[model samples]
Structure formats: structure tokens, C-alpha cells
Target: MLRDHLQRYDPVFQHAAIGMALISLQGSFIQVNPVLCELLGYSQQQPDSISQLDHAYQDVLSAVTEFGGSLQSQPLPQGTFELQIQQTAGRQLTVTIHLTLIYDEQVPQYYLAQFENRSLLTETKTQLLSTETMLRDIQDSYQQLLEKMPLAVLITRNGVIQYVNPAALQLVHARDQSEAIGISTDEIVDSSYHYSLSERRKTYYEHQTPLQSITYLINCMDGQQKLVEGFTLLINYDGGPAAVGVFKDITEQREKEEFMMQSEKLTMAGQLAAGIAHEIRNPLTSINGFMKLMRSSDRSSEAYFDIMESELKRIELIVNELLVLSKPQSKHKSQAVDILPVIDQVVTLMDVQATLKNIEILCDKPDSPVQIVGEVNQLKQVFINLLKNGMDAMASSGSIHVMITTNEHEVLISVKDEGSGMTAEQIQQLGQPFYTTKETGTGLGYMITQNIIHNHGGSIQIDSVPDRGTTFTVKLPKLVSVEASSN
Candidate 1:
């Protein structure tokens, strides 16, 4: 009856695309489909045992060690595996086997295994391995090139620094790469330029546009400033949106260019001064002679003559200053000057003007002397100009504070005023030749003060907040006393 049933389904079994089989109690094939025969490269005749088809039957036996003792004592096992089989033509074929066991009356009856080709999957895995190796080598080469770049390279996401190369560490004076990571972009940029830079970045990110190169100032951790030209582009970093920047520091070159421009302006000013002095000297001499004659002719108007003479002297003073400013300086004598006394004298001279405006002038100094090597009168001129400007800034009653503080290597004299102060733009233009705030100001007073302070190997720093006040800080290298130097 089973043979009749098999014969009835024979045509269906033979035509099916998938392999199918039935084995007897001894593991010999009782029925096999044509697909199974073709897949295994077998002839029309069936194999004697299923284990004979598996080249590694010992490995298959090891996989079912729990099937111990007599076959009837253990349950049949089932598993999947990849098997390499030698075909009739002696060529090897790799295939996957899904194997199971059938049972009859609680005893092992037959083994059944289905085979499939695995060559395509194996080739795909090999190609993937080669591609991964190539990708890793390319990434390593890019990392090496980034480290060796001379200009600072930075990668940032959401305004937070992510990666910094060696050159970036050097640019910010950082000790190592760890120091700059996670720092905000604002921290490295100069405060004055921070807002503009942030706004520009926002625009670029919003529009998905690349940033153009810009020259700007950056403040380092060491308190030094650098003029940097920077360029930025959007990038995908570590699978997230980010920006990459490259910077070149140009501080020294910019300073040299500024110095050349200043030099040219000075040369032009000198030539104008020489020509003007020649043209004005003759008229000034004639005016002085007439004023003296008028004073003698009219003794009753002696006060008027004194006033005229004073005005003439004031003109002479301005001309003398211009001549000095234009010419290349000859060496001037230097002396050890105790700046406290000079400051005190200038304060005394300016006190009357302060008093007229209902302003109080307060002076503070250390008990110990503050000494510097400079020209005494020149130092006096610098202080006088600074104090006078402080007074002029005050529209009405306010206090002008002057303090002299000494450090190990320098003396700091700060002049602060409680008055309407300057804006940032005004402060930047303070030292230019004809820049001024007062209606009647020539602007030469501040310029000459700056020149004198520079000549004395000192620096001037100004700080102001609009509607609050202004402070002018003067730093000069301290001169060690002879007794101290000897020690």
C-alpha cells in the first residue's frame, strides 16, 4: 500500500524545485527526489547511508554526544551546518544542511538532511573583509596628515570643540590636545569679535553655506593676542553635522605693516612741520616785537599787555612742539626720576581747573618711592595730559582718582574719572593723528602723550564704559636705585 502511495505521488515529487527525501530505519535512502540528486551531484541510484554523504561524520557525531548509549535510550537530535562534499566529478561544493531525525515507536527510524549552495554568501563575506581593510588604511592616512598640518585644524559641532590638531594646540598656547576639547568657541575668540563670529557661524549653518575666510583677533590663554585668518566649511564628523576650520596666525606680519604705515605718516607730518615752521617764524617774531613795543607805550594798559604776551607765548609753545614732533629725535639725557613727585606737581597744577568745575582730585600712592628712568619734563607732560583729559570728560561735579602702584619690575599709575566715558570705537581711534572728542581739541595732546610714554619704554592702556567712567593706566619699567642695584 505504501509503495502504491509513493508511485501515485512520484510525478509531483520528481517535479518539485526543493529537495525532499525519506530514509529507512537503517538511515538508507528509501525515497529521494530528482532535485536532491541533482543538488548533491549524485547519480540516479541512492546512497547506502546518509552519514556516507557527510565528509565529517565524526564532527556530526561529536555535535550529538548527548545521544549516548543505545540509540533507543536517547532522543533524536536536530541541527543545521555547512558541509563540504566531493561530487562525482571530483569538484568540491559548499552547502548548508538542515538535518532532522524521524522516529517510529519511540526508536530512531531515519535521518533527513536538506542541502543548499553557500558559495555566493562566502564570496560576499570575503569582499566585505577586503573593503573594511582598505577603509581602515585610508582613515589612518588621513589622521596622520591632520597631525602634521602646520595651520591649526579644528572640528566643532554645535559651537563646542570636538577635535583639535597639534597646530591648534600651539595656536591657543595649550599644553596638549586634552586642554582644548569641549571648550566653547567663544572662549578662544577675542571678546570684541566674539558676537560677530557667532552670528556669522549661525548664518552659515542655517543656510548650509560655507564660511568665507576672515582675518580677526583671537585671545590666547597666556594673555597674548594673535591676528588669525580663518576659513570654515561644513562637514559630517563622526556621523553628525559639524564644521571644520583652518587658521593661520598673522600677528607679526600685520604689526610690521602697521609700523610701516605709521612711519610714512610720521615722515609726512615732519615735512609739513618743517615747511610750516619756516613760513610762520617770521610772522611770530614781528608779532612779539610789536607786543613788547605796545607794552612800553601804554603803561596804564599793563594788564592787557601781559595778556597779549601770554597769548604770544602760548603760540610759541605750540610751534615748538610741532617742530619737535616732526624732526628725527637726537639722543636725549635720561635720569632716574621718582614719578611720585612729578605726579604730585602735575596734580597741583591741574587742581585749580578741577576746583573751578566743582570736581575733587584725589591722589593715592604707595609710601615707598616709584622710580623710573625717563625724562622728567616728558613724564610730567604725559601725566598733565592724562589728568586734563580726565577733567574735561566730566561735565560737572565728579571725582578724579589718581593712584600709583608699584610692582617688582614696573610702576602702574592709573588715572580714573567719574564722568561720561568713551565707546569702544572712540578708544580704538584714540591714538590717530587728528581723532578727538572735544569740540575745541586739536587731538595732539593725547598723541604726544602716547609718543612720550612709548619713548620711555612704557605702555598706556585705556578702559571705559559709556555713561560710567574712564581709566587710563600707565605702566613704566621701574628703575632700581643705585644702592639697590649694588646689593
Candidate 2:
């Protein structure tokens, strides 16, 4: 009966697609199909045993026995394992073996083993592990590069700081990264910029937009303030959205620029000295004439004394304005300044020069005081430069109109001149260093003017027609009054 049963399955076993083998309970092969011989690079004449094919066969047999199933049991145990075996040519191949026990008449016969080749799967897994390791190494290298870069770098997520490079730590006077991480960005940025920064972050988070480069005042951990110019872009970090900022410390650079501006102011004052002298001479002449009249009469009229006093005061006012322009601004603090008064004072100072050029400066003052926050001297310099430029642009008698207008959020001061005017290309080149339209102009005046306005959170717009005229419109952020703030 056993012989008959074996004969019945012989054809199917011999023609099996995968490697197949039948082994006795003693672990020696009872039958080996042609596929099994070819898979292991063996011939029919070679010795065939389960132990010879797999070194761990004993362990597998032990595991099968530990499952508490006897070889002669009715329901036998079956299992699968992965093993590496050596072919006849000494080459190793990984394979999975499915082993099962067969029975005839409730008695165990032999173990049937089916071998499936898994060399390709094992090789593919190894390649995948290698690729992952390479990617990890690349990430580590980038991290090192970021750590060693000189430019300050900061990373934030959801309005909270997540990482700060060493340079950023130094820039903000932070002792370590832990001091800055996990803190709100508002803690470091100046309060004035909080609203704008918040709005920018919102835009970036919703649309993945980038922030343009701009200067910011950062409050350091050590209570010092630093000026940084930076730009930010959105990036994917750790499987989430983040913002990375690259910055440079510009505090020293700004100080240098301030010194250059101060030097230019002095130079400009020197250029206007002739007009100032002419202005002072009239007042001096008036005082001299009044003194002579007082000396000639035994009882000088009170009007003569009053006239002398008025002339002296006028001289004093001109001298004071010159001194203010010539004096070096070592350290100027920004404060709430009434824009109208500053413009009035500038118009007064430049009026002498304007008259010398036969240019009448007609100032259209606002009914109410327009207020802004800025350095008074710098603000003076801005208008002085503008008014001077207007005077220089005109060749003959013309009016330079100074108009002050205000809105809820900003104050606009327009200096319109009926000069030769400028082409669009010339207007575009207004703020460049050493590029001037005037023959004697240094071109630094407009550049410095633009810089001052920008520092004050303001902007300058120029509109001109070639033959008609040119108008320079300056816009500055308005200072909210106490009442307005409370409201």
C-alpha cells in the first residue's frame, strides 16, 4: 500500500517547479527531485542529507520537537525557515524552506521540504539599507555645515523658535542654544516689529511664501540691542513645516553709515555757509543801525531797543540752526517728534539758500500737528537734502512747494520743485552713491536721505515729468497718540 501511494504522487513530486525533497526521521534524504538537485548544484550521484544541505537543520528539528508533536502523531507539525546553504560550487545562496511531515495510515513516513530561492530579496534589502545609511550620512554632514557657518541661522516653527545656530546664539548674546529654543520669536524681536513679523509668519505658513531681506532690531538676552539684516524661507524639517532665517549682524555697519551721514551733513552745512553769511549780515546790519540810533539820542525810544533785541534773536536763531547741522551726532535716540515742526525748522534753515538761488520755498503746513518717531537731526537732514536737491535742480526763479499731509497710519511730506525735472532712468538712479544729476553734486545726499527714511520705517517716492517738474514724496509711519492708543 505504501509503494502504491508513493507511486501515485511520484509524477507530481518529480515535476514540481520549486526544489523538493523527502527526508526520513533520521534526517537522511529518502527521495530528491531533479529540481532540488539543480537548485543546490548537485547531481543524483552526490550524497543527500538534510544536515548536509543545512548546517542548522538540527536546531530546526529541535524547534519542531519542542512544539510537542510526535513524528507518528495524526496531526503533524509544519513550519518554514530561512537558511543559507552552500551550493556545489561553494557559492552561498539564501533560501526559504517550507517543511511538512507526511503520514500514511496514521504512521509518519517522511519530511517533505520545499525550497524557494530568496537571494534577490536578500540583496535588495541590503541595497535598501545601504541607501538609508548614505542618506543619514548626508543629513549629518549638512547639520555640521550649518553649525560651523559664520552667518547666523535660526529655525522656527509655528511662531516658536526651534533651533538656533552658534552664530545666532552669539548674535543675540545667548549663552547656548537651549536659551533661545522653545521661546516665542517675539521675545527676541523688538516690540515695534511684532505685528509685521506675525503677519509675515501667517502669510508664510498659509502659502509657503518667503520673507524678503530687511533690517530688524533684536533684543538680546544680555539686554543689548543688535541690528540684523535677514531673510526667511519656508522649509520642510523633521516631516513638518519650518522657517529658516539667515542673518548678518549689521549694527557696526549701521554705525559706520551714520558716521558717513554725519560727515555729509557737515559738508552740506559748509556748502550753505555763504547763504548763511548773507542771512546773518542783514540781522547784524539792523542791530548796528539800531544801536547807532540809540547812541545818537539822549533818550532812546523803547522801539529801538526792541528792534535791536529782535535782530539779535534772529542772528542767534540762524547760528543755532547752523550749529545743529554742523555738530556731529555721536548717539541720537529716536523719539516721538512732531513732523510739522521739523519741516518748519528745515524750511527756515534752507530758506536762505533757497533765496540765494531765487527759489521761494512755499510751505503748506498742516492744520494739525503730524507726529512720527525718529531721530530729530536725521529727520532734519532728510528734508535739508530734499530741499537742497530741489534748489539745485532749478536753473532760474521757481517755487519749491513743501506740503504736509497726514492720514491715520502715516504722514506724507512732499517737496515738489519746478526744476528741469528728471527722466525715469535718472529718477531710478537717484539713490546710488556718487551718481548725481548736478554738475557739483556728490550724489551721496540723496542716498543718505533714502537711508535715513528707510531706517525710520519710511519710504521715498519720486514722480517727475521731463519738462514740467519733480516731486519727492516722503512717507513715514505715524506715531499713535496716547488717546489713540487707548482707543
Per-candidate Cα lDDT values, in order, are: 0.77, 0.80
Point to the candidate with the largest TM-score. 2
Q: Residues 1-487, candidate 1: write the lDDT tens digits.
A: 5476468657866887666565444434556677876766665565553445434234433332322223444454666677675565676667776666655455565545555667668778888999988987987897898899999999999888999999999998999878899998888888888878888787876788878887778888798999999899888888899999999999988999999999998886885566456445655676677677776884546665675676567566566656556544225578888898999999999999899999999999988778899888888888988988988899999899999998779999999998789999999988765467875454667878888888888999999999889999999999888898889
Q: Residue 299 deviation, candidate 2, in Å?
A: 32
Could you tell me the TM-score of candidate 1? 0.46
Q: Which stretches of candidate 2 lie over 4 Å from their true place?
A: 1-77, 85-92, 105-108, 274-487
Number of the predicted model whose lDDT against the real structure is largest: 2
Measured by C-alpha RMSD in angstroms, how accurate is candidate 1?
17.9
Q: Residue 128: error of model 2 in Å? A: 2.8
What lDDT, from 0 to 1, does candidate 2 have? 0.80
